[model samples]
Target: MARITHGIACSHIPVLGYAFDHGKEGEAYFKPAFDGFGWTRQFMAEEKPDVVILVYNDHASAFDMKIIPTFAIGCGELYGPADEGFGPRPVPPVEGHADLAWHIAQSLILDEFDMTIINEMEVDHGLTVPLSMMYGHVDKWPTKVIPLAVNVVTYPPPSGNRCWALGEAIARAVESFPEDLKVQVWGTGGMSHQLQGPRAGLINKEWDNRFLDRLVGDTQELRHIPHIEYLRETGSEGIEMVMWLIMRGALGKSTKALHRHYHVPVSNTALGHMVLEPVDGTVPPSPTLEGNSAAAQARIA
Candidate 1:
């Protein structure tokens, strides 16, 4: 069976790149993030995963308020950067893993996930930001990517539980593929920092620290919390912390943490990264439990 070589999670703030380009904040913070994921770049060089399931939210670029699908899978041959008021990035168009993507889409729909399959769509900073951070300029992205863009903009987006379920669906999709190749799944955005309205720049050091601590060992607890609560406590836009659910869902409950890092002051965001690989061949505990409190059942369901 082809295994997930490694999993990574981070925020895709396009402005972070603009800052690095314009020399607003010193390079001290961003540099380490790129270097620490050096293994990712190297893994791409060696393992050259045939597919990278990228989970990111679109920034009103490709799919505006017009029609926001809770989960949209891109099967396009190429994807360009969105203008998004900042103008498109000067980077080569992203290549897609059509074969693997189609498999996931079909499987997800059969599983009743109601995903939107896109063929000719442009990805915004929501994706390009993390891509740039993880992999610098190269003649071409080493591996093909299966873009899964979730709608975090519109009202009543998918619940944190739903996103977590999608991660499980993703694992199943990869496992079902008949190909012999390595695969990687990435969930981008949120450690904790709110940007939007006058409440922008709201950073809760205490909440952020607690969230990180639980993220590694007690993610099940974090999933039980409601989205609105995250907003009230963390901030409105900070609810994107729900995005982290996708990452937690990908790892086995008994997995070991390889590395972790946290830093604030990325413009107005808390930059965070964590890498989790399978441990001693132990399978992750099932997210669902047979008998649990109504709340626990609700969180996993």
Candidate 2:
């Protein structure tokens, strides 16, 4: 069976594309923060996983406000770069693991996560920015991928607890797959920053640190935090931390942290990244009964 070897979580700030395109790689806005994440390239190199199941949310770039899928899986052969207001990034297309994505979609639906199956979908900076950070320009990505896209843009998105539970479901799917391959599951976005509307450029370093701490040792408390509280306490539009629980769930109860990095810039968002490897004999924590129950009812309601 394919083993999900590790999980990587990160933030996908659009400014990185701007920095790359403008040839200002040395500018104060991007230099130090970019340098701090040097560990990412190293971890991917050492692990050299066979497949990477990337967990990220789409910006309105690919799927518009008109139709949103709470969870979507890409089974396409390749994904193109997105055109933000400025223009598309000059990057090669992203390739996918079709066989693995197909199996995952079947398994997740059987387990009742009810995801949208997409055979052809283009990934925006949300997936590519992190890919660039993690793998750079190889002839091909070091590892193939199964793209999981969550919906965080529209109102009444999936709950934090729901995202967490999906992580557990993903672990089950990965373990049950009948291949003997090493895999990495990556969750991207948010530490405590906001974009869109008047609340743009807000950062809460204190909350970001607390989030990292709780995410490691006390995720239950973090799962119980409601979406409104995240918006009110963090920022109106900065609830992307909901995606992090997916990585946490995949890692199960305890993990050895290989590395962690955090930075906030004037470019309108806070950036963070984490690398977690599961410890052997780590059992999956019992699903948060109350939170999952409430999420189920919300779906039904």
Q: List model 2 lDDT by residue over 22-98, tens digit each.
A: 66667877887777667778877877988888888898877997889999988877777778776778777777888
* Regions of model 1 farther than 4 Å from truth: 20-47, 217-219, 280-301
- By summed lDDT, which 10 consecutive residues of candidate 2 come out lowest? 281-290
As for candidate 1, its clashing pairs are 252-284
Cα TM-score per model: 0.85, 0.89
Candidate 1: what lDDT? 0.71
Tell me how far the alpha carbon of residue 159 in candidate 1 is from the true structure, in angstroms, after superposition. 1.3
lDDT per residue for candidate 1 within 142-235, as digits (tens), equals 7778888887767787788788777766676666677786887778877666777878888777887777676665346766778777787777
Cα deviation of 31 in candidate 1 (Å)?
A: 5.2
